[model samples]
Target: MIKNSYIPIPVKVDKIRFETEDKLIKTFDLVFMDKEEEKAFRYYPGQFAELSILGKGESPIGIASSPTESGFLRFTVMKVGVVTTALHNFDEGAIMGVRGPLGNWYPIEEMKGKNVVIVGGGFAFTTLRSLLIYMLDKKNRKNYGEITCIYGARTPGLLCYRDELKEWEKRKDMSLYQCIDWKFGAEGPIEEAAVEGWEPINLKEPSKTKIKKDIKKFTAFVPQLVSAVKPGAKDSYAIVCGPPIMIKFTIPVLTELGFPPERIINSLENRMKCGIGKCGRCNIGPKYVCKDGPVFSLKELEKLPKEY
Candidate 1:
C-alpha cells in the first residue's frame, strides 16, 4: 500500500520505549506526518518497512504493531549498528521516514478456523507479537480457532513487550508459553530461578509435565520448548520466527508433531533489505525476501537455494 517504493514517507517518532534491560533494544511508535499517509500506509503482521534517517542510511525493520492498532506504527529495533543506534539515541517527537508495509504476510485468511501456533525466540518476537495481537482482536478472533504462542529469550530482561506477555498469559483464549535459557532452570541458584510469577520446570521430566496447562515457564531452548508444548496439528498451522539455529531445530519438532511443511511458516526478516525488490540483497534463488517473502512456509523455503 506504499505510494512510492523509492521515496520514504515522512513520520514522527511519537514515543520510544526501551524493550530490554540491557537497553540495546527499543520500540519506536511512529505517527505518519500526514493523516492521509497514516490511513493509506496499511500493513499486516510479518511485513517490514525501511526506516530512514538523513545521512544515516535505511534499516529494514519488521512492523511490530498490529493493524488493529490504528494511527501509528511500531518497530522494535535492536541497537546493533549505526542506524539502529541512532534510532536509540532519538527521543520522542523525532521526525523520521518510513518506506513500507511491504512483503507478504502471515496466512491470516487461511488460518481462519484453524488452531494457530506461534513460536519465536529473542528479538524475533516483534512481528510475532503483531500476528498474535491481530488474531486476538475481537473482530478477528471469531475467524480463528485456539491460539498457542511459545516464545523464548536468554533471560527475562531480554524479552520484548514484557507487560503484554504478562497480560497474554492471563487470557483464556490463547495459551502462552514462555521460556528462558537452560541456565535459568532449577539447576541454577534459587534466587535466579525465582523470577517473579515464574515457575521453573525440570527438563528431565516427561513432556506432559513440562507443559502442563498450569505451567507456562520453562528453562530450555525454543526448540525444546516447542517439543514440550506439542501443539496439535489437526487443522492447525505453526508460524515461527527466530534465529536461524532456532528455526533449524524447531522445524523438525513441528514436523514430528505432524505439521506438514506447508503448515510450518517462517519469516526471513534478517535477510531483508531495500524493502522493494530492486535491491538484490535479499535474493534466495529466484525469490526476493523483501518482495516474495520475509514470510514463507517451510515447503516454499525448501524449494529455495537455502542461502539464508
Candidate 2:
C-alpha cells in the first residue's frame, strides 16, 4: 500500500455530458468551489487527475481539456469498470474529490517550430486532444509547424467529440483523417440513421469493404499520411496514443518517415490507482508513471520494463 499525504479538494461539477454513444464515456467540466483553489490550479498538456466519488472510490483520468481555457478544468472518462460506471451517472452541481494535475507533460516547448503528427485511437485520444488544442490556440499557433491528426475507432459511432472533429476538419492550417474498422452497412438501423449527416462517406458495404487485419497496412499508411502533411524532414515531431497494437506498428513507420526516437512522444496507460505518485500501482521501475510520466519520448521509454 502507498502512503497518502495530500488533502482532497472539493470541486463542484459544473456540467457532465455524454461524449460518445457508449453510455460508458462522459465529460465533466468542473471548477473549484473555492476561488482561491481555482487561482492556484495549473497544469500542462498530458497530465492527469485523481478523481473520487466519495464512497465509490478513485480513478486516474487524463485532463482532457486544454490549459488554454481558464476558469475551469475538464476530464473525459470511459466507464470500463465499477467506479467508472458510478461516475458516469454523476451530473451538474455534483461534488467530487480531486487530488492532482499530475504526471509529466509532452515536450511542447521542445517541439516548438516543428511539424506535429498526432495519431490516436478510441478514448486514449482524450489527452491528445488537449495537446492539439494547445498547439492550435491563436497565440501559440505560430510556434508550431503544420499539424496533422490521424484518429480511428472500432466504429464510427464509437468516436468521441463529433462536433470538435468537424471543427478541426475546417481548419486550413491542420489536416485530419478519421477511419473506422468495421464497415458501416454491417449494422442494421443504426447505420442508416447515423450516416444522415456525416461526411466523407467512404466506408464500403460489408461485402466490398476490406477488413484491415494486416498490421503492415497500418504501418504503410503512417508515412503516406505524414508525407501528405509535412513533406520534408527538417524539424518534426510525432505523438501517438492508442491501443498497444497500434503503437507497436506505428513506431516503425514514424522512424521510416525520418522522425528520430527522441522526436516521438507516447503516453503509457496502466492501472493508475492514484493520479499522483503516492500510489505505487503505477510505478514503472524507479520512476512513478503518475509522477515522472504518462507521456515520454521513445528514447526515455526504452529503459522501462515491458510490463506496461
Candidate 3:
C-alpha cells in the first residue's frame, strides 16, 4: 500500500500564457523543482494531473503538450472554479503541486497509417494540440496518411493558440480549417440574412458584432466546415474534443462522411474530487473516468451508461 498518494510534487510555474481574449483560460508551463524529477517526467496527451494551489485545493486538468515536447509539462486550464481561478491568478515562478499523468491517452499507435481528422472547439483543443504536434513532427509525419484539422471557436477572440494556428495553416504537411460561429454586422452572414429580409436563410456567422477580414473567412459552424472537408472514414480516425453540444453534433457529421464509431475518439473530462479514482463518483458505469479514461473510442463509450 503506497501511503503517499496524497502528497503532491513541488513544481515551479515557468511561464504563463493567456490564449484567449477573455482571459478565462491560461496555459501554464511548469518544471519540477528537483532537477532529477524534471528529467524523469513522462506523460502522453489526453492524460491529466491534479494541480494544487495550497489553500484552494486541487483540480484535474489535461496535459496539453506532447511527450515530444521536452523540459516542461504544460497544462491549459479554464478558470471555472476555486482552484482553477487561483491557478489563473498565480504568477510566473509561483511554486505549485502536481499529482500525476492520470487517465488514458489517445491511441497514437493504432492511428498509425490512418489518415486523421481532428475536431476541436474553444479550450478543449488542448490535447488535440498535443496529438497534432506529435503527428506532424517530421520524424512521425510519414507514419500517417493525409492529416486534416477542423477547429473553431465562438469568435476569433475565443480561439486558443492563435499564433500556432497561423503557423499550422502554413504547414504543408497538414490541412488546417479554422472557423468562427458567425461573422457580425454588414459583411457577416447575419447582415446578409437581414438584408435578404430574414425569411429563414442560414446565417454564416452566429453573432451580430463586426470582426476583421481574416476572421471573416471562417464564418461557419465547426460542423458545417467539417462536412465541407469530407475526409474519408474508410482509412482514417477522427478525434474530437469540444463542448458537449458541439461534440454531440460533430459525431453525426463524421459518420455521415463514413467514419465509424471505433475510429472516432473522445477526450473526456469530469468533476473529480480525487485524482486516483478512489472516490468512486466519476463512474460512468464500472469505469472511473479519472483512472480508466479521459479518452475513449465512441464504441467503447457506447457500451457504458449514457448517464455521462
Question: What TM-score do all the candidates reach, one by one?
Answer: 0.93, 0.84, 0.89
Error of 1 at 278 (Å): 1.3
Deviating ranges (above 4 Å) for candidate 1: 1-3, 182-210, 270-272
Tens-place lDDT per residue, model 3, 233-254, is: 8899999999998899889989
Off by over 4 Å in 3: 1-3, 184-217
Q: Worst ten-residue run, lDDT, model 2? A: 213-222
Rank by lDDT, descending? 1, 3, 2
lDDT of 1 at 169: 91
Q: Provide the lDDT at 12 for model 2.
A: 89
Best by TM-score: 1
Q: What's model 2's overall lDDT?
A: 0.74
The number of residue pairs in model 1 that clash at the backbone is 0
Candidate 2 residue lDDT tens string, 76-149: 88887777787787778888877777788888899998888888888888889999999999999999998878
Candidate 1, 1-308: lDDT as tens digits: 55557788999999998899878899999999999988888888889899999789889899999999998899999997888988999999999999988899999988899999999999999899999999999999999998999999888888899999999999999999998874434464333253655565545532554456688986677887788788899999999999999999899889989999999999996555577788678788899888999899999999988687
TM-score result, candidate 3: 0.89
Residue 154, model 2: Cα distance from true site in angstroms? 1.7
TM-score of 2: 0.84
